[model samples]
Target: MALKGSFERYGAVAVASHWLSAALILALIPLGFLMQDATGETRLIFYRIHVLVGVVAGMLTLFRLLWWAAFDHRPAPLAASRAQHMIARITHVGLYAVLIALVVSGVAMTAKSNLGAGLVSGDVALISPSPIRVPPRLAHGVAARLLLALLVLHLAGALYHHWMKRDETLSRMLPRTR
Candidate 1:
């Protein structure tokens, strides 16, 4: 497999970043729900894990953007019209925008709540089931829901291309031997 993308396939880096980000997002969603509902040390532990994973995922996102800016050379839309191509591009941009918003809001919420420093220094116990609602925290929740919707749309589009349109659109992103 090539480390750089070609007209027919994604690079190894792109494929790895895509899968890792997806996995992290999938894990983080459940963790977010659990942490929000939890209390005491349980919530604290979950929050720490969530924040750490989110940071890692955010770093991966940064690298993915850099990869696109510096090295991306993937194939064009195989048989799609100009309108379809535009829509695809919009969706991709929206996904990245939503992801960045989610991470930023989450980090801001953590800082505003003092969860990170408190967790480290034992300054305050993260035991509040009904924690204070700040703007960033609220935005984080909203972004989570929006991200879910975007992910569903992305999956639907890929499935449509693979099952109905009989295209390699999905396979091109899939991590498989060529």
Candidate 2:
């Protein structure tokens, strides 16, 4: 496992970042929903956990984007029709954009609503209700939905490449085995 990507496949760092981000985001989607219906001490606990995990995921995602830009290059696109290639590119860009949007909106909502302070003081009253329709909260919700849709498109593309095209597109991101 090289640190940087090769022409054929992603490097170890990229693979690790991809899987870790995927796991975190998957956890977050469910956690976010659960946090909505929670109350009392359970709500506070969920809020605390959600903030902690969300911060980690946001930072990791930011680092991954920086790494891709500054330190790495992805493998060349596997042979495909122009439309397929275009769709893949769009999906990739959308994924990155939506991830960034989610992070930004989450942070903004936290700061604007004093969520961190509320969580720290164990004052659930300080936390804004999810139904308030604030800009950042609204943006966060929209971004989450967009991320889900983009992920579905991404998985569809990967599965198409792996099963239909019988190509290395999916394998390129897979962990290398001995």
Candidate 3:
């Protein structure tokens, strides 16, 4: 597959970034939930790993955005009603915005609390008695829910295009095998 997107479909870079971001988001959702209830050593370990993965995901997301802005062009939209096209555009933008918000809020929460220092020094005491009612923490939770909703909408749109409209909407993002 070409490294740069063509007029018809996404190239290898876009395809890879999309899937990688999806995987990271999937991992993060579960990890975020798991770490919340965990305790003792397990909690510490989960927090460390979650932060590490979140950072990677954030960097990858930024890279993807920059790549698209500076080097890649998206394929032309498939034929669809104005409403469908508008919804698709809105969902796409929402996904990017939510992902960015999640990353920023998460980082802010960590930095503003003991989480960041705990991760650095492996000092359990530093992490105990977590901060309460912080703005960033609240924003992070809200962003997570928004991300989930957007993801479901995005998936539904892809399925609708592939199954009902029978267009290249889904396949355009898939990596070519030959």
Candidate 4:
């Protein structure tokens, strides 16, 4: 069955980017939180991995956003009422916002926070291969918090759609496409 509104199966590029991003975020979030609780070498190791993934995610976000604008390729809207449509659109956009926010926040936190000293790669020079002495204001007090809040909202919306609404909010992203 087809989705509602103009929502259609994402194109090849969109689908590929979507899945790659999903896998990365899914892996990164827990790893990041876990690293926060670690220290010394282990913390350093996770920090490096986190930065490595963040840089890649940042690149992917740019490409995906560009693809969305240039290719005009996106998923079809869900087959729901106007209210549902609005909620779906808001949620989807929020997802993008959160992902970008998280990526940018982490990058800023490292660069401006100068926390990069902790993110060593044994000798890898992915991004200057050094620690940031002071992460920016945007990355610290406000932006990072905003990212975390948006992430919670995004997850809540997903849960709402999945359990409360019993819709295909998450499922549609699957390859099967209903």
RMSD of each: 1.6, 1.6, 1.2, 5.2
Per-residue alpha-carbon lDDT of candidate 1 for residues 70-126, written as tens digits (9 for 90 to 100): 888777668987877887887888889988998899788767776767567654354
Estimate the overall C-alpha local distance difference test score of candidate 1: 0.83
- List runs of model 1 lying over 4 Å from the truth: 122-124, 130-132
RMSD of 2: 1.6
107-168 per-residue lDDT for model 4 (tens digits) = 66666643664444343233333344354434433544555566676678768878988977
Per-residue C-alpha lDDT of model 2 across residues 1-178, encoded as one tens digit per residue:
9989999999999999999989998998989888888876777888788878888988898899899889999898788999998898899889888888887888788777767687889887766464224689989888888889999999999999899989998898999996
The better candidate by lDDT, 3 or 4, is: 3
Task: State the displacement of the C-alpha of residue 84, model 2, in Å, after optimal TM-score superposition.
Answer: 1.2
Clashes of each: 0, 0, 0, 17
TM per prediction: 0.92, 0.93, 0.95, 0.68
Please state the error at residue 164 of candidate 3 in Å: 1.6
Best by TM-score: 3
Q: lDDT-based ranking, best first? A: 3, 2, 1, 4
Model 2 lDDT vs. the true structure? 0.85
Candidate 2 at residue 26, lDDT?
A: 92
TM-score of structure candidate 1: 0.92
Query: Model 4 off-target regions past 4 Å?
Result: 1-7, 120-172, 176-178
Tell how far residue 49 is off in model 4, in angstroms.
0.4
Single out the weakest 10-residue window by summed lDDT for candidate 2. Answer: 125-134
Question: In lDDT terms, which candidate is top?
Answer: 3
How many angstroms is residue 137 displaced in model 4 relative to the true structure, after the best TM-score fit? 8.0
